[model samples]
Target: MQIRPCADAFYASELEPWSEYISGQQGKDPGYDVLGWMIEETHKRGMEFHAWMNPYRISNSATAFATSGAANHPAKLHPEWTMKYDNLLIYRPALPEVKQHLLNVVDDLISKYDVDGIHFDDYFYPYPKGGVEIDDAADYAKYGAGYSNVGDFRRAQVDEVIEKIHNLLVAKKPGIVFSISPYGVWRNKASDPVAGSDSNSLQNYDDLYADVRKWCQNGWIDLVVPQLYASTSNVNMNFTKMCTWWNANSFEAKLAIGHALYRFGVPAEGAPYQTLDQLSDQFRISRSNKNTCGSFLFNATCFNENKINILSRLAQVYADKALIPVIGKESEAAPAKAGDIAVEGRTIAWKEQPGMRYAVYTVKPSSVEGKWDAKLTAVLAEPSWLAPGAGNYAVSVLNRDNAESELSQPVKVD
Candidate 1:
């Protein structure tokens, strides 16, 4: 699950320090903290929570609606680090101060919250404007000594942020995953001989100034969720072809498809995701591919509206519990086994590692063996869990990289 923590000069934070970014619901006597509730609820459902942040975007419009609170926004405070183009305010990535500010914000999210990972989508350069060029000429003049091409310079600047953030995140929170969801196509075959995908779509490398392929090859991020937000059957922007290209290019990071659930049944200029069958085939393609780790749907609210009965169809794919994949090379040695499982009524308790999560599994007496084929019954951050009902339960320690330790002795439930 991706929670938009910082967006459009406002945030979903309750910390008094984040008052600069209001949720617009502050007048309810108490400020609403969306991040807190999201984490708790997502965990309760045994899902990993990824906090998605738009690094540069400030105000969507420069006209300045009173609802935006642009006057006291952090961008206003650090006007030197911001650029305005096409009615949008973007933080200039060339500045060291801008990187530091983003570092601080993300560090706060990782250190303070219990997020499993931090996600950044492909909004690095604010999707280029046709008539207006980014106002980073001054920045380029000041900091563009070593680089000749301003485009390459901008790409380098974004690279610095990703590299520095990855370093800092690993240092501060060793196991926290850092990921980037850049635009789907890195480059067309016409652009690069090695680029695999065949498309005329806006390339992230050329247009957005994001070298997503380099980030993957450099092993800067733990995962990459490419926004393959197009119909699977669309010839030029074929979803399965894009998935194949990305999976082939996944150097050291896992690849997850950014599914377009919101686009289902929605009309588009050329092609439309007008049927649920397109999505079903897309899921089938992803499942068949060894490189495709998972899917991250675009918007969470799509299911709430029951649009075309999407929630029901998707539920069939998500019925079974799935664990977050651990980066094998990044994981630490499995923790010591969970000690002495004890159950009273429906509650179960056991010894645990300080920062590790525990996975509870239930196996039928007929199926019990050294190898447990059953999926996890529950995963809890705390040492204890309230089992859903009576069953033969066993516990295992999940390490920082989400690697599971050996299971503890099973304790029968009454």
Candidate 2:
């Protein structure tokens, strides 16, 4: 259940707000603060917690109506604000009330969770359906006052919501990253001669009504990860070529690739994906593109099925640790370097610097005597750490924006 009901309540009961005070009262209720505990557990394990949301999706299937949860769902309550495009139920994007409702939802989300980032994938206007013309002409006539065409008006509606959301993120959590992974192709050359991708494919612009390229150019989002779910040799939509294309267009935002890991070993996915090297090749392409900071694997659960030996290739590629690429306001002030560092056995402690995360590096022969390689060992939210094994350790400070300080004096361990 959500803490606060948004526009339509989305069929949720009002729960307690997430806060340190609520979290500190853990023993009172058995189900108290699950979200808070998840954040704590994730941070404790040196991983970032990002909240992913499909902003407009209400119901996945028509059968969802069978459940009592469906009865109170906003889509059911305010059916006027919804569209049944195929069996999928979605909020009408052109409505002002829907935009305000979505803003309220996002406001409630960021206000409650201790998430490191907010992630949204290509879920704007539903991918255009065949023979199904969007019947939003009346909505457009009402709300599309300044725009010329319905397409342009549709895109503008999406743009306004995104701009408002970006402003909200900036105001509420300046350091929090807001990212969108839209369809890989903004437009095919056939669609937009000059700015379109060379490949022929469905676009985020004309079809989906999501001007993802415009978002990147406008710098409204922090990161623009295109779902480049293709192989290196895929001539139509080559992975390498797409990476380069996105980099050139990403303006001030960082770029990342969205890999289709679910198709890696699937036979029906075609020749390119049949070869296990597909993912490795994609990573190689992403790394070669200097603007790419990281990547996201689709259906994140795909990695768990290692019977296909998915980890081996990536293990070699990711043998060393790297600090998170700096994001958020690039001009924010950096935190003070961790000083008065001490080592007791394999357990190291440093000066407590509140509101900052600590990065601990394992010192090898190359990193000793202050010539550090910065091979990150672990990032800790707490001031102390119990090293995995005996070795030299050094610590650094990281601001909310992930700005890192110089490594502290290395302490030796047997």
CA deviation > 4 Å runs, candidate 1: 1-22, 25-47, 65-70, 267-272, 328-333, 343-349, 365-372, 382-391, 409-414
Candidate No. with top lDDT: 1
Q: What lDDT does each candidate get?
A: 0.76, 0.75
For candidate 2, list the clashing residue pairs, or say none: none
TM per candidate comes to 0.86, 0.89
| RMSD in Å for all candidates | 3.5, 4.9
Q: Write the per-residue lDDT of candidate 2 for residues 351-407, one digit (tens) a residue.
A: 998778899888766635637554678888889989888877889998777888888
Ten-residue region with minimum lDDT total, candidate 1: 8-17
lDDT of 2: 0.75
TM-score of 1: 0.86
Judged by whole-model lDDT over C-alpha atoms, candidate 1 comes out at 0.76
Give Cα distance to truth, residue 357, candidate 1, Å. 2.4
